[model samples]
Target: MKTLKSRPSAILFSCRARRGVLARGLNTTREIAMPEYLSPGVYVEEVDAGTQRIPGISTSIDRARWQSLVAEFKKTVVPQAPAWTDSNDTDPGVTLLELFAWLTENLLYRAHDIPERGRNAALRAATALSVLGHRCTTECATLTRAHFFAGQLLDAATLQAEQDYHREKLRRHNRMLHGFGIVSGLGVHVEATSDPGGGRVIVDPGYAIDRCGEEIAVCTGATLAFPSVGNEAFVSLRFWEHPCPPDSPSASGEPDVTRVEEACVIGFAQAVSPPALALARLIRADGGWRVDPAFVPPRAGAVMA
Candidate 1:
């Protein structure tokens, strides 16, 4: 019997052979023959193709782990500094720890994903506003139109009805789809009241859009009166549009009517629905009314006051 000298390659070969045996036991019929190592320096053993490779662990810190790490740090500090007992948010040490933790959390998030500038660059020139504008223009262009044949008789009523329909469609397009709001100059100001105990305010002339997409113009401004019933009252501008026909018939014997009849009503209370815009909040104290400094006027199409 000849004795074989032990080497590192021989030990590796024995381990691989044992692994192949175990693999064969687990429903694998493939046979693996150990390579003879006559001259040994370094030998490479191929891993089993059927075996699943273990994935590397992620170094990214998640929200839960970050919070745990902050908590652990806080706990560790108590043992090192027994004199430091205050752990409230008002404490300088705790505030600094929380600030540092927040910064670290943000840094970790940025490290794990593409930068914001890179993502924005990927979008090129397209934006939310541009996409919406294109969609509105396309929809308006593709709107259905009534077709008239050569022999079809045209009447004033029919023409007027068609015109009104298209006008309404255009109005809706501009109001709902295109976007409507006060373009500029709708400022509410406190004014002097004739009655000593009454509160009065005046709205500056401005152009705005109503909830129904109708354009409203404050040509000469409007006055709002706040009653002394409550300590606080919200002032709002209300709009009403209705069809107003002329009292006399037109020259063609048809009714001359204005479809877009605009009216502005200043109310002491907040408006509950559309076609309205909140102007200001009034606070009454010592029999005098003043505009609340904290009141913020919301834009059109926003939540109703």
Candidate 2:
């Protein structure tokens, strides 16, 4: 099926020690044992969306526009779509405003050039996809915020319309994609990632489906594989971590371990310093993702939960 709405997935929560300090023997020891790093610093491991910084004013404007988009979307768009589908719906339960807000935040305010202007064409060209998962802190602050938001800047109507347009497009084309696996030449905008062994993806409207043999792989908020079961396809998912930030250097000249978890530290090949573990955790949380600490950087700093 076409990519579905992102739902809650593997997530790590940041819970502070009630006392904030471990006593001599740490009397009240109760291992709640949530998904966490067996590393030095107390951290929660997760997969999350990446964030891009903009000017202060620009951020303010972007937030304002997002508010407007949500309002308009709740009024105009959301009313039309259902939350989900038995097979998948022509309309979505998520709002155009929400999608646009993400695009504004993550897409860095990029717009599509009417690649095909229709559902069929858009799907053929879209190799990547996204989904909407939740760990919504619902808090205004970005701290401990796990969600989908990573990209550049955006303008007024241009950004909203662009997001709105794709969201609607995703709604329109989802059913078709769910039925047939990958479709090339169908024009849809996706962010091509430099990840090895991952599909070249595009994220707008929150999802995309790629055909891999008998499996119809889905990409949106997370990556999943669906085995085509007769006329229908059953989905299996795999998530990817957002890339390490460009500016922040994690590896030292000789390769200093960034954020060490219970597992690995250096990329077997790159050794060029990946994202700091702290940063990686934040990104994963943004997407409400799951992490296998084995693949993460080795632990460093303080003991985590």
Candidate 3:
């Protein structure tokens, strides 16, 4: 006769109880754990998966809501004595509503784009701002100054806001126009010094033209020569365009070098010296505008041509 063997039945209990009993007081933490079974069997426990879900906000819904608001505003808010019949895009009032709806939809989408960890923090800050009767600025993939102010009333909290508004607008304008505009401290320039004859370097003069009355004919740092001691040093750079267009005679035939001067630029000359020179000494690892003194040495008072 064949003999039969029996396996021990599995027992389930709170991890807190097992921790004290099986761990012998070594561990005192309370947590659920599976009991060890003498017999071989598969055991599985369903764990709660926590994921905060944000509901989708459709753009069509936003558009419909805004259209309804616009209709209400025209019918009830505005007096019909003068007549407010224009309800199409041609009407500035209706256009404003459409723009607001588009922006609202975009903002809702952007909110979800934030990382999960950052979303919580951003939402908390937004809530605080809302309570204070202010809303957090929505960022777009491609943002411009025009997007910020379109029939919206700007409520500046402090005196600095006035300056900040101008600075931000100008910065965006310069970025879009690139070389045509002058932006102080927004770029870097490096040059090898011809003075006193050493491996010394100086910040390029393109950024300095803002202070001096002398105008820049060409803002490209190409005028500067490379240092003999190093390879091409500059990692990134910027160039300024001559504010005045090349003297060109118009159809009427008269040389015009006229240019409208820009106003309200941000900070100026943050970098006193070339970054490479500012840091202790130059090494192969350090990179910036390089000038070779042996060949094509820098000339004194060689203004940009």
| Every candidate's CA RMSD | 36.8, 24.4, 28.6
TM-score, one value per model: 0.43, 0.18, 0.19
**Candidate 3 deviant stretches above 4 angstroms:** 1-156, 179-198, 208-232, 235-305
lDDT of all predictions: 0.45, 0.24, 0.28
The residue-by-residue lDDT of candidate 2 on 50-154, one tens digit each, is 212211211012222233333433434344564421233334544565677677556443542222223222222111221111011112232221223568455
Task: Give the C-alpha lDDT of model 2.
Answer: 0.24
Checking candidate 3 for backbone clashes, the offending pairs are: 226-290, 226-291, 226-292, 227-290, 227-291, 227-292, 228-292, 233-288, 234-288
State candidate 1's TM-score.
0.43
Among all candidates shown, the one with the greatest TM-score: 1
The true-versus-predicted C-alpha distance at residue 177 of model 3, in Å, is: 2.2
Between prediction 1 and prediction 3, which has the larger TM-score? 1
Error of 3 at 266 (Å): 17
Candidate 2 regions with alpha-carbon error over 4 angstroms = 1-157, 177-305
Clashes of 2: 51
Q: For model 3, how does the per-residue alpha-carbon lDDT over 1-305 read when each residue is reduced to its tens digit?
A: 01001111111222222111111000111011223332222111111112222122111112222333334345443454435554466777888988997986697688755344543343333222222221112232443232345677665443346654665554433333341223332233333454332223332323322212211221222111223333333221211111222246667664343442221111111131211011111223344433333322111133333
Candidate 3 RMSD computed on C-alpha atoms after optimal superposition onto the true structure: 28.6
